[model samples]
Structures are given as C-alpha cells and as structure tokens.
Target: MELQQMRYVVAIAETNSFTRAAERCLVAQSALSHQIARLERELGAKLFERTSRRVRLTPAGAAFLPAARQCLDAAERAAAQAAAAVGEVRGRLAVGLIPTVAAVDVPGALRDFRQKYPHVRIGLCVGASDDLVEQVREGALEVAFLGLPTTVVPKGVNTYELARDRHVAVVAPDHPLAEESTVDLRRLSAEVFVDMPAGTAGRIQSDLAFSAAGLSRDVAFEVTSADYMARLVGEGLGIALLPSAYVPRLTGVTTIEVIDAPSRAEYVIWSRTVCTPAASAFLAILGISTGPGTPDRGPVPGSSVRVAAE
Candidate 1:
C-alpha cells in the first residue's frame, strides 16, 4: 500500500533481480525483500516468484506492475506540478530521438532550452522509431521524436506533427538512375537495394510502397546507420530508399526524388500523462500546445506534406 513498496515492486520487476533492484532503490537487499514480503502479505498474493538464479514476477505481480508505475508517475507529476506552480522548470528530462529526425534542429533546440532553464538536465536516447515509441509509452522517456507511418498513430499517446519528408532514392553518382531527376519505383525493382534493417520506419514505408506498386526490390545490403547506408551506396554496393533528410551529402552518392514513393511523417509523441515542466518547455519551443485537449497541428507552413500511408 505504501508508495515505497510500489517502487520496490516496480524496480524488482524491471530489473528481474532483487539484488539489482535493491541497489537501484539504494536500499539493503534484506530490507527490500522484507518490504516486498509485507506488501505481498497485505495483498494476500505473492508478487514475485523467487529462485536461486533469478527473480520473476508472478501473474499477480504482472497485473500489479502497470498500476504501480501509474501510481509512481502520478506522484512524480504531482511534485513536478508543485514545482511548476512556482515557475520552476528544473528537472531531468529524458527525450528520445530516432535516427532519421533531421527536420527538427535538435542541437539548436537543446542549446536554447539549456540557456533558458539552466538547472534542467537533459538526457537523449537514440533508437529506431518503434523502440522510441515503446519507450515513451512505458514512461522511460518523457517525449520522443518519431518517424511514423502517415496513416497509423499509436494509441494512448499524443503526437504533434513536426515534419514530413518524401522518401528518395540514393545511388552511386555513376549509376544510370542517378542522372534522372526523378525515377519510378518500378524501375529500381531489379536494382540491389541497400536499406535499414526491417522494422524501421523508412524500411517499412519502402516495403509497403513497393508492395503497393507490385514490385519487389532485391535487398542486397541491410545496415542500421544512415551514414553507412550512404557509404554502401557510394561504393556501388546497391541503391537505397531513405527519407530525404537522412540522405548523407557524400561525394559518390546521388539522391533522386522517387516519383511515387511514400512519405514519412515525423512526430513528437508523448504519453497523455501529466506533462513535466521541462517537457512543456521543450514542446513550447517547438510551437506546440501542451494542453490535454489540444488537437494535432496537422502540417504547418514550411513542413513537407505527408502522403497517405500505404
């Protein structure tokens, strides 16, 4: 029932090790176990199934975990709200970024945010769009810049469209398709495609576009980094479909607009939970409203128009 007990349960569930959880909670192993036992007794069910090698949550624990996190988040938000009431925006803010987030001048934004709130700490996490979305959903990150499909938005999250850029084709400068101002997706169906690993926003869009066009690309090289993909294309390894912003300015590579390619939409997404002061300040800098009832600013001037998702 105690908030500290909820904290212990969450920590133990996340780490899956009572020892590590105790370390994370900055408490002794025995005392942490004692508190958890008390909680289980009060609830009349065991929360964790402990073994010599590992600690895992029981079904009861699994059901209780999300509620525990919600309680903790509510408490944290209450504290943050009290601090915000005094016009203070000083706290740690965890922000997530996907690899293809080029539309937002992240460095410039961070610099301005730091200048305005000198005491607020910023932590940056970079990952694939799906991973970043999941992190935001799980409360691991306060906000994330995600490259999502135009038609689909995750549930229980608020998203503000930041920018949308068309997917383009990149190839070696000497490649035949490089000279063309715009090439059709069917023309490159036979060409070797260098792409990010499956499940990435760009890759998913590319796959869907090709499928929609009744074409299949020969994916010869799969890389996780945009820079590496550009390098691979520069070396004549293969061609790649990438967000225009992610195409590197490399000497041997040439970027061409794809005639019928799908566009990827970039969004700043966060859970609908109460906003932290730092998150609010960052959103304000991006010209977004942080109110709960605020609607999505579909596409602003200077932002690329998004195509319907395939």
Candidate 2:
C-alpha cells in the first residue's frame, strides 16, 4: 500500500480513536477512513476492527504494522542521507537520558544543537542507563546519556565516560543525622533508605558499595524518579543516597557529604551500527568524538577526542 496509508494506519493504531488520529495527522476523519478502506480492499484483509466505542488493530493489521514502521523509518533515513550529501544536516536526533544526568546540561546542549541545526528534529526519552543503552544499540535512539556504577561497563553501544562523582546522604531537615557535616556508609547503612528499584543500573552502585563494605541496608521505599526519591527523604519517609550533583537542586532536605559513598559514572552512548548525521552533530556539540565509522556510520564531523565508552 501507499506510504500515506501506512502513516494513517500507524496514527490510528497509536491514538486508538479515529477522531484523535485525524486531528494528529491534520486530516479529516472521513479521508483517513477512506484511505484505510482502500488499503484494506487492496490487501484483501481489514486492518482495523472499528466499533462505536473503540478502534483497534485486527490480526492482519498487527502483523503488517512492524514492516510498515520499518519502511517509514528507512524512507526517512534515506531522505536524511540524501540531504547530508548536499551539505545539509536535517533529520531526527533521538536522544535518551537518565533523570539524574549531571555531566552536561541536557537542556543547554539541546538548545545549542537546535540553534546550530534548526532543521533537525530533536526527540528526547528518559530511562534507566541499561534501558537507554539498549535503545541506542537497537537504533530506537541514536544517542543516550547514562549513569552506572564505575565497576560496570556498558555493552553493545559506543560509550564516552562523561563524569564520575560520589553519592551524598540525603535526609529530612529534622532527622537525627541532618546536623552531620559528613557521614560514612557504615552510619548511613544503619538508617532506612529510599532508593531506586532493585537490580537497576541506578541502584546497583549503592548496592555494590554497601555489599563491598559488608553492610546491609533497609530500603523502605523504591521509586523510579530521582525527584520522588528526594521527596521521600524530605518527608522523613526515609533517608537516601544520591549523586552529589543532584542534591543541591532538591528541596526540603539536607545533604551530608559521604566520605566513603558509592560512586556513579556517567556516560554518553550512541549506536554502534549507524551514527546518524544528526547524532554525530549532537555528539560534536558536546565535544565528544567517536572517530570514523565502520561501514554504516556517516562522517563524524568535529571529532577531536577519540576514546572508547568503557
């Protein structure tokens, strides 16, 4: 079927409402319906099961959607490559990051990239370090900023170590340890904690540190958001250990330097297969260089520091 038909189908499937899809696609509902009907007739199978209350993909539609999406992405990349040959950099720059990214100011970096390459479409996703690395490797995201324990290395994607810093203790203002200027892991471990979910890259650093010291901690609350973790500490729900860079911005809490705390390493990762021109430009803007490509990547401009992500 036509690319336009595939676009309409994807929009409808994503929105699950014909009216909403039409609004999103900037097309009339009737025209979208007409295109889907025409495509279904040509394929000899209906794509969607429509009812008065809801619209969902049929088995045929579900089977065909993945290829349709791949074709659309490939078409966009082809167009981007063609534009690149003409000395123009205009395409999607999909970047993923963790909530506690501290090395480079993400908003400032993105703002500069936008100012220099106004034609590029920027996309952002926030996730855990492991998930972001996987997204970069799979081509879902062209670049990502991650934070993990110093002992662990990101696998599969190209990585650049950005910064390394120790975690600090966070507690409510009236908490017993709030008056302390510095605390070590032994003292901090004795208190209940608010931490990231178990087994995630975000949690691993602290987990490893405590284990290495032969200490055990009681995690009273587990959350995904760093802000929420801070909030829990502020509310006296529990104390927490977080990257030092993050403590200054948090409210209602007191930060205590931890002399022997877990250390987190920040990294910027990009796809090993294809460093899209847009991705390359963003990396250069950060003064990061991944060197020449290995058959699939485009020319990496503004490259100076050639280094591995490990």
Candidate 3:
C-alpha cells in the first residue's frame, strides 16, 4: 500500500492502541484507523487484531513492521544525502587555471581551503585562458582562473575579479636592457623576442601594446607555457613579455618594467548554472581580496592588485 499507510500500520503496532498511536503521530484516531484499514485491505492481510482494551499485531504485521520502518528510514536518509550533496561543502571540485595563476599563490590558497574542507576533492587543469574558458563552458570544469580580454565567457558563466597581475619584460641578467628600471616601448621593438603562442591572452595583450605604440615585434622563439618562457629568458634565448607573477624561479633572467602598457586585470570565472560544494568553497577563498585591481610596480616591474570577491 501507500508509504503513509505503512507508517500508520507501524505506528499502531508500536503503540498497541489506535487512540494512543494517533496521538503519538499527531493525527486523528479516525484518520489513522482508516489508513491502517486501507493498508490491510490492499495487502490482503490483517495488520492488527483489535479489542476494546488493546490492539495487538497480527502474524503478518509482526513480519512486515520492521521492513516498513526500514523503508521509511531509507527514504529519509536518501533525501538528507541529496540535500547534503547540494548544500554542503563536501564533494569533488574540478577547476581550470591559466598559466599565470598556476605560477601565483593559488596552491597556497587551495591548501588553506583543503584544511577547512578536507572531504572535498580538488581537481586542477592548467591551460591557456581560451582553453580554460571552453572547458568551463562545456562543463568539463566547474570554474577556472582565466586570463581575459579575448575570451568570450559563455552566456551561462559568471566572472569575479580576483587580482590583476601586470605584464613585464624578462631578459637575461647581462642583457643591455636588464639594468634599466623601466624600458620605453621603442627600446623593445627591434629586439628578438620570445613570445607566447598566438591564442593566449598574454600574446594578445603583448600584440596590442606593441601595436598601440606604433612598433612591430621581432620573433625569436615561441612557447606556450610561462614556465618555459622564463627558462628560455634565463638561458638568454631572447627577451619575452609575460605576466609579472608567472615569472617563477628565475635563475639568470631579469624582469624589466614596462613603462607604457598597463590596465591588465586577472579574474576568476565560473558557470552560473550550478557548482559543486568544493567549487563554491574554493571560490569563497579566492574572493577574499574583493577590492579594485592593484597597480603595477617593482624594481623590475611587478605590481599585484588584490581584489576581494563580492
């Protein structure tokens, strides 16, 4: 019979009195009796043997009461688990990161988040901004730290400003431009440069800056990863322009300031459709600096603006 009918049968059997069971269940005695009677008629078995003084369980009722209780319990537990999966921060989070963020303090931030929510599974995929955006839009990733400008964030995705890390020129320490506090755009024009591949946000920004200053680029080497770019610069392969923070572990490379091009901002973007508990929790950690983009500065030219997420 109906789950409610089963509940009524179990309640009456436990109390041994329809009146007491109705009171325990917060229902009218007549209603409870009707439900239990309906259950017995549907099952073709009497659930209870009743007298004016007491209600006793029939043989079939004794056999079925525990099963009925278990069924109800299972239903309730399933509902609770579904809610926990939706609202609690205890599940898998798949995230995509750009080259610049992989070099930044995201690992530290994730460590902190893991300490707070150890049960959450964190999966990371590192790629260019365009690729990461595509992953997020396609639901391959829940969210991502992506380089912007040319990326078309799909309609169902949302964006948050994290921090803006500016671009700088990295050269061999012994290069003529290495000692310069800040090089003019004209000085970089004729130099053979190690550049990011054409599709990346850094490449687009670099191209725009050169074009805006009425200069043309001289290509020496091309690489996709920022880490590789740094190594190439360290080896004196050629000068390269890259995000300031992405320059990690520079041995012989010196990062020089770019005096002309600014306005670079980095953001964390995600889907608005839905997010796992782990994804939401990580977003909370990344959004802590919810202010404006930090201005660029440094001995070479590294400035980070810490923006808090709203």
Candidate 4:
C-alpha cells in the first residue's frame, strides 16, 4: 500500500472517526475511505470495524499500526535529510516554549530565525514545562524550551542548557517590600502567596524553597499560567514567586530578590530519534553564541546579564 494510505490508516486510528481523520489530514472523507479500502484489499483483510457510533481497529490493523507509523516517520526523515543536503531547510518546525520564554526571547529570536532561514516554516506553542516535555516526546514539537528542576533529560531527546533565570518575590509597587533592594524569604513569612498549581515544576521549586526554610507555603491562590499570575500580583491579589526574567513591570507590581528561592535552569530539548532539516536549522540558530543560547556558556566578562545571584 502507498504511504498516503498508511497515513490515512494512522490518522483514522488516532482520531477513531474517518470524518475527523479526513479533516485533520486535509482530505475528503470519501478519499480517505477509498484509500483505506485499497489498503485493506492489498492486505487481504479488513482493517477497521465501523458502527453508527464507534470505529474500532481490527486485529490486523492493530498489529500493522506500529509498522505503518515507522514507515511514515522514516519516509519523512529521509525527505528532511535530502532537503538539508541541498542547503535548503524549508519545512514546518513545531517548537514549544514555556510562557516566560515565549514572552521574552521568542520575539527577538523569531525575528532573527525567520530572517536567517526564511524558507523554514515555524510553529510556536506555549505551555507549562511538563506539558511541553510531553509534547516533544509525542512528536507534537520538534524542540522545546523547558524550565525543569534537575538536568534529567527527557527520554529519547538530547538536552542543551539554555539559560538560568532566578526566582524572585513579586509584589505590588509601594507595598512594604518594594523599595528594598533585596530581602530574605523569611521577611514575607506571614504574607499570602500566589503560586503555581501543585505538581508543576515551578510549584515544586517553590515548595522546595519554602521547605528548606522550615516553612510551608501559604498560597493565596494556585495559578497555571505565568501571565495570569503576574496579572494577579499586579492587581494586589498576593505576592507571587516566579522567574525574575519574565515578571513584567506592571504599574503596581514590583519584583525583589527572594533571597533563598530556588533558581531554575531552562533547557532546549529535541528528539534524538526525529531530526527534520527545519529542526536542525532552528537548532543551529539556537546554538549560536548570541540570543538565548549565549547565557548557558557560563557568564561572559563584561556581560550585563547575571547568571546567578551572589
């Protein structure tokens, strides 16, 4: 059977509905049905059992699914390698970025990347670190910028340290702690805190920071998005502990050193098993000594950016 037919089969298996699969694959439902029928005829077995409400893969289809996926992955990788050889890196590169990075580095980085590799089509998605890591594992993203606790790399992917951003206490300007150049964590022992939801990388770090001081966090609210947390802090909701680099200078919000808060490391992760030419080119752009890549190579002499707080 042709690769197109295999694609149809895989899509159908994923979506569990021919109409939905056809929509995702940008083909007509009739065309997808015909292709699947052709594949079934070639294999001499029916691949799916469809009823009014459900679609189920037959035994043969279930067994053949992995092989079909491998075939498609191999074919796509081959095409990407061939395109790279001609020095034309033109394909879709799906990238995942945590919200902070998306808000800060992405604007300038994309401007440079697009100018340098104009032919490469880039898709950007923003999510939490854990969600982004899962996306890379599932082939939804070719590369991602993740804020993780340890250096434990994602399975089947290579990790490159990108930059280190510090965690700081954010509060409203003109608040009690705003004018202080820096303050220890204990100073806010009684204040309510706005923090990331439990089990997230950010929340874990926040917990650790407080735990180290023999204190438990008094969370005023749990939030999922960094931007939302920042806005909440700006509204005088509560003190928020977040990466210092991403805290916007909102009119009422102020950021100060959380003396003992944990510093977070951001990493660039890409699948070792899947390398597209467009992904490779984007990686190249990220590898250069400029942009977000520069901060990882230790600190430069005369560089204004602080890698760590003294």
Candidate 5:
C-alpha cells in the first residue's frame, strides 16, 4: 500500500530477480523480500511466482502492475507540478541530439535555458536519428532533435518540425558537374558515391531520390560523419549526396543543388506520455509552445537562418 512498497514490486517485476531488484531499489534483498511478503499477506494473494531460475508476476501481480506504474507516474507529476507552481524548474533533463544538429543553435539555447533555470541539470547525448528517436520513445530521453524523411512520426511520440533543407550533391571542384548550378540525379548514376550508411535519415532520403529516378549508385564508401564524407569528396575519392545543411565548407569541394532531390526535415520529438517541466522550459527557449499536446510552431527567434550541420 505504501509508495515505497509499490516501487519495490515494480522494480522486482521489471528486473525479475530479487537480488537485482534490491540493488536497483537500494535496499537489502532480505528487506525487499520481507516487504513484498507483507504486501502479499495484506492483499490475501500471492503476487509473484518465484523460482530459482526466474521470477514472474502471478495473475494478481500482472493485473496490479499497470496501476502501480500509474501511481508512481502520478506521484512524480504531482511533485513536478508543485515545483513548477513556485516557478522553479529543477530536475534532470536528458536531451538527445543527432551528431549533425548544427542547424539548431543548441549551445545558445542551453546557455539561455541554464540562465533561466539554474537548478535544472542538463544532459545532452549525441546519437543517430533512429537511435535518438527510439530513446525518446522508451523514455530514456526527455526530447531530441532528429533529421527525418517525410515520414510519419512514431506512434507514441509527438514531433514539431523545426526546419527542412534540400539535399545537395558535393564533389571535388575539378569534377565535371562542379560548375553546374544544379544537376539531375540521373546524370550521376554511373559515378561512385560516398554516403552515410543505410538506415540513416540522410542516406534514406538519398536512396529515395535515386530510386525515384530509376537509378542506382555505386556506393564506394559508407561513412557516418558528415565532415568525413566532405573530406572524402574533397579528395576526389567519390561524389556525395548530403543534406544541404551538412555540406561542409572545404576548399576542394563544391556543393550543387540536386534538381529533384528529396529534402530532409529536422524535427524536435518527445514522448507524448511524459513532459517534464525542464523539458517544457527547454522547448520554450527553442520558441516552441508546450500545451496539452504537441503544437506546430515556428523557428527559434533569431535562428531562422540555416547553418551548416557539423
């Protein structure tokens, strides 16, 4: 019946081991077992089926699990609301960013967010768009900036489109197509291409464009970093297709617009189920309005101009 006991039950159910659950709960195994036993006795039902090999929730425990989680979430939200009422945004806010998020003024946003809510601890994690999106869905991150194709947002997440940039082709200055203002993708079908690995947002967009043109590219190299891709293109190793924002400034490389390329859209995404005060504050700093659900808003004030993605 106690919140602590509920936490113990939920942790034990999740971990499936008393020893591990006790470790997670920061309590002795004996004490955790005692509490669970007490709860079972009070409820007049066995909540868990424990064996040496594994632990699992019994019928009653399985039925009670969701309510236990709801109670914990409600309690946390209540505490956060109380803190917000006092205009205090104080908690850990884990924000995820793609490796090439230079389009957003992340540092400046963080600086202003910290200045306004000094007690809010911020943790930034850089990752690929897919991985970051999964983390947001799993509640591992409060929010993230991701580069996505024109696709539906994940079911449990809400996204606000931040910006969109056209995909462009980069090549050595001496390359035949370098002088052109724009070129058709079909013209480059025979050339070896340097590109991000498959499954990345940039790579997916490039693939779609090529597929649309009924062309296939010879991928000479698969790189993860945009800067490295630029370096390879600058060395004349291979031509590359990248989001215009990720086209690096290099003396030997020239970027030309892809005449019929698919554009990459950058979005700010978060779980629809949870929105902490710190997360809300960060969104506000980015010029997004947080309400009952996700709202479509404009760019961050003074950040409308596009910048090269690092």
Candidate 6:
C-alpha cells in the first residue's frame, strides 16, 4: 500500500465521490479509479461500494480506513522529526479545547506560535474535556485544554495543571437570586439548572459538588454550547454553575460567588506517545515541559531542531 494509493482511498472515503476525490487528489477520475482498483487487488478486498448515486465504504474499507489514516499520520510525523533534526519545524499542530478554557489565551498563543514557526500548520477543535483528552490520547490532537473537577484527573494523557477556580452561579437578571452576592451548593441545588449533558466532565464537577453536599439539583436544560446555556439562563430557563472566570462574560446574567462551590482545575494535555516539535514549542510558550529534547523559542542557529516526542 503505497502512501499515494492510501491517500487516494482516504480522499475518496472522505468525499464519497470518485470525481470529487480525484479533484481533491489533483488527478484524473480514471487514474484515481485505477489506483483504487490496484489497491483492492493487492488487499484482496473491495474498499468501497460504488453506486450510481453515491459511494460508501464497504466493511473491508471500514476496517482499513483508520489504519490508513494512522499510517499517513505516522509518515508525516517521521518527516517532521527529520526536519526538526535540522533547525526547522514543519507539521500540522492540531489542538483541542473546551469552550470554557480561560487559563491561556488561545488565539494569542497561536499568534505567538505562528510568529515563531510560520511553516507549521495549525488546527483547532472545540470539544468537551473528556472528548479532548481522548483525542490527545489517540494522537488526533497534539495538545488539548481541559477543565474537570479538582478531584478528577484525566486517565491516559500526559497533563500539566494550568490553574484552578471555584464555580459560580449564573442567574437571569430578573431572577430572584440575581441580587445575591454569594450562594451555597445547597441553595443552588434547590433551583432548576441549565448544564452540559449529564455524565460529561463539565457537568460532573457540579454534580460531584452537590452530591457531596447531599443536595440534588434538577438539570432542566441540557446543551452543548456554554454560550447557548447562558442564553437559556438569560431567558430564566434555569440557573447554572460554571467556572468563575467564564461566567463574567455572559450577558444578561448575574454571577454570584458560590460560598460552597465546586472547584475545577484546568489542564493542558498532550499525547504521551507523540510530541511533535511544533507541539513542544507551543507547550514551551506556556512553560509546559515536553519531556526531553523539546525545541526552544525557535530553530537554533547552527543546531538541528529538538525532537521532544517520547
């Protein structure tokens, strides 16, 4: 399985059209089809099911897709390591974060990273802490920002603690508790709440807090976006408990300090297995160690770039 053949297969699988995939690969439709046919002949299985109207991966293709992508990533990483060995950084830096990230300015961080390594490509993903951690563990993301209850630490990824803060109550401007300067878990528990989906890391922080306080709160609205949750709270749907640093920015809501609040810790996590040079450089900006051999501010004048991956 040549990388180009695999690339054609991946592009076709993603676009679900031979014509579009050929366009994406910058090759002719017949040439792309010939390659796929050759790949199928070598693998002894059809990779895709082509119909008059649509294209879909066959069972064999489903099994091969993930490994194919992994191969492509590994190949790219190998090239990046070689470049890093010679005072240059070139690779995609995929980053993931939750919407509530507050410890470091993401755009600013990317700006600084770009200024230093213009050759490196950057990508961003916004997701829940749990999901982001999983992405980092899978090497789908080079780094991720997470927020979880202080009691819980991510299981598989390498992490660096950024900061910690208590949860605050968000109530609509016209709600009865809007004027309150401080509240407790028990008090907040008495009211309905708007929160992230149950069982999520973000929701669990508040859940654990109230559960420990022997209080049960009703989560009347389950939303994925924090901004949308704040909108629901603004409409008096329910109150919410969010990290103190994030609630201040929500319009049409009053933030009350939670006297007996749940505290959450922010973490920056990266793949324990593959720490690319670009990733290490980004981490270094935050003073986060990328194990050994991490690149410094930029490429060294006369030295090869440091390869920090374990």
Model 4 per-residue lDDT at 286: 50
lDDT of 1 by residue, 1-310 (tens): 8999999999999999999999999999999999999999999999999999999999999999999998887787777777889998866688998776766777777877888888777899888888887888777888898887677675677888766678888899999988899989889898999988887775888888888999888888888887888889989999988787666444568999889977778888887765678898887766666886666755444323232222
Candidate 6 residue pairs in backbone clash? 87-305
lDDT of 1: 0.82
lDDT digits (tens) for residues 1-310 of candidate 6? 7999989989999999999999999999999999999999999999999999999999999999999998999899999999999989998999999998876677877887899999999999999998898888888899998888888888887777667778889999999998888888877878999999999999999889888888898998999999999999999999998887777667888889888988888878888787999898888766666876543222223222221211
Candidate 4's TM-score: 0.79
Error of 6 at 261 (Å): 0.7
Q: What would the per-residue lDDT of candidate 2 be over residues 124-184, giving only the tens digit for each residue?
A: 9899988988888878999998888988878998877776778889999999998999999
lDDT for model 3: 0.70
Give the least accurate 10-residue stretch of model 1, judged by summed lDDT.
Answer: 301-310
lDDT of each: 0.82, 0.86, 0.70, 0.75, 0.81, 0.85
Model 2 misplaced stretches (Cα beyond 4 Å): 293-310
TM-score of 1: 0.76
Tell me the tens digit of each residue's lDDT in model 4 across 1-310: 7999999999999999999999999999999999899889999999999999989899999999999997897787677777788877766789898776522255565677789888777888878888888888877788887776643445566666656767888888757888898887787777888888899887887777777888775897898877788778877888887777666544458889876767677677776567677776676655423223433343334322233322
**TM values, all candidates:** 0.76, 0.91, 0.63, 0.79, 0.71, 0.91
Cα error, residue 232 of model 4, in Å, equals 2.6
What does candidate 3's lDDT look like per residue over 17-107, in tens digits? 8998889889999999888878788889998988888889889999989889867745644554575667656556787887666323677
- Give the lDDT of residue 167 in candidate 5: 77
* C-alpha-based local distance difference test score of model 5: 0.81
Candidate 3 TM-score over all chains jointly: 0.63
Better of 5 and 6 by TM-score: 6
TM-score, candidate 2, is 0.91
